[model samples]
Target: MTILQPQVGHETLELLTNVLIGNGFSIGISSQFNYSSLVELCDLNIIDKKLFEELETSNFEFVMKTLVNADKLDKIYNRTDSTFLHAYGRIKRSLIEAIGKIHPEKYEIDLSDNYVLNKTMVRHSKRIFSTNYDMLLYWMILEDKKHVDFFGRSHNKDGTLRFTPNRESEKQVFHLHGALHLYLNDGYIEKLNTSDHLANHSSIVELIKEMIELGRMPLFISEGNGEEKKKSILNNEYLNFCYKSLEDLEGSITVFGHSLDNEVDSHIIHALNNAKKLSRVNYCIYTEGKSEPVIQLEMSRITYLFSGKEVVFYDSESIRNNMRVIEFYV
Candidate 1:
């Protein structure tokens, strides 16, 4: 493991930041703060206690995989029962509710700095990809309402909402992992409109609850293993498109807030490895009290994943001054 620290006042830091500002880059956001928010939601009784206990006993990803597998194998008279399926459904709804409750809708004003940072990134970047199920990025894009395009449903001249296909935009946001605002309606993934009725976090929770009551489950890939996630992605049209978009990405990409865990994040590794046009990969390491060896190990792991690519490790705080908004809910 090799440690390379670029100081705040160093020329290298300034050059890297300027490069990021000028060149086209892709961003990969993961479950760093969102996971903690979910845990907190559980503590606050927003998520059911039994389901929370199951999540604590076994990881949330594991529980999701188990439920999905059981549902698939239910007809074979496996150990899965109706009660288990019902419980799983309840857990799914609870997870969405929890995400909505802790989502960054109301905090957009508080996170104005983060919004600016992301907006600037979006202005320069081609795509922004996130593995979190929360709607933080979606809320940010809606708040900014500038160059970023969601590519969602559009209204025709007839005043009816209709699905538009093959609409291309330079500044796009992809939810690599399905988000709380996307729902499965008649075999198509559609974005839920948050601007309607001044919907806040709690209203979004209620909307999801209503969807659950109407027999619609949120489209989210919460499988524990990378292969399972890949399978789920392939099975879903929207997720498959997101995965393909990742594979087709060209140029530099910056990864932030993701741990790059091999087990659960193999898809990301595979995408980054397959991106032949990727010139440089910048990894933002949040080194608060972490030792040199720990940071080195993380950088080496990412370097190993990206083999021949130029990998740069920089302090996350230096790259973006509003680290608090990115690391925690405001």
Candidate 2:
């Protein structure tokens, strides 16, 4: 397979960051007054009048410090509850948009059929995993008639199967986190399956408003240790499919767009580390600035467990163009 490296541009990166933050807000992971939400809530006065200046200023600072730490965020909130709600809301919104809007049209990549074809070949890769909640990759695979198994929650609930029907044997895309469009209410994870609603919900504004008014709540996951452990792949079929796929695949694994942020997901990385068929794995992160804490942790985990394997980082921009000419040798 020929190697292709696509470079990500500053504008493209900015758009991606904006999209992630925006989606995070809509999901209540960040404060309802975060940047993108502010654009929506500000005009509607969902933000309190007296706190308008404070909210707006805090939003600006949130963008400035990158919200990478707690002390920086503590500047705005006096309590941990406020900090959690605000930051979580923003993160949720940012992730939603990142998965939704990342594409050539938004990033100036030539995502024509040819480019898409090239990218699809790369993704036809063995044992792929994503922590994202969006269905963009699934949609792309469907469009291409390529088969990739998803090992994530079919719905974010217990005792429910998360299976992708008609998946072929050669390729896989596993989702570690529960998908946003999929909801779990009564031991069932229901798909809000709609072409238009997935991308543009006409009532999203109202829905977000309602969720914001509801106050700090964990809509993403049910509380308690028992419920938390149930969500793990060790018990979930969809996620275990990914684990087995990683064990069976005969080449190196590559990752993109994931931040290595959660400990539960560290299981996947460790599994890949222990895989017999895999010798060395590569990581293609979105930015070089994240080299110290985020990327370093990924490496530390892998090296500590599998010293023989290698972890390499690539700038997203440099590899963005490789899609245009990818001839998958792997």
The numbered model that scores best in lDDT is: 1
RMSD (Å) per prediction? 7.5, 12.9
**True-vs-predicted CA distance for residue 299, candidate 2, Å:** 6.3
- For each candidate, the alpha-carbon lDDT, in order, equals 0.58, 0.40
Instruction: Count clashing residue pairs in model 2.
Output: 27
Over the stretch 9-53, how does candidate 2's per-residue lDDT look in tens digits? 432222221111112212222122123222233222233222324
Please tell me which predicted candidate would have the highest TM-score against the true structure: 1
Q: Provide the lDDT at 167 for model 1.
A: 62
lDDT of 2: 0.40
Q: Any runs in candidate 1 off by more than 4 Å, and if so which?
A: 1-93, 100-124, 147-150, 154-165, 197-202, 322-330
lDDT of 1: 0.58
lDDT of 1 by residue, 212-272 (tens): 5565666676545677678777877778877787777676676765667788889777877
Worst 10 residues of 2 by lDDT: 17-26
Clashing pairs in 1: none
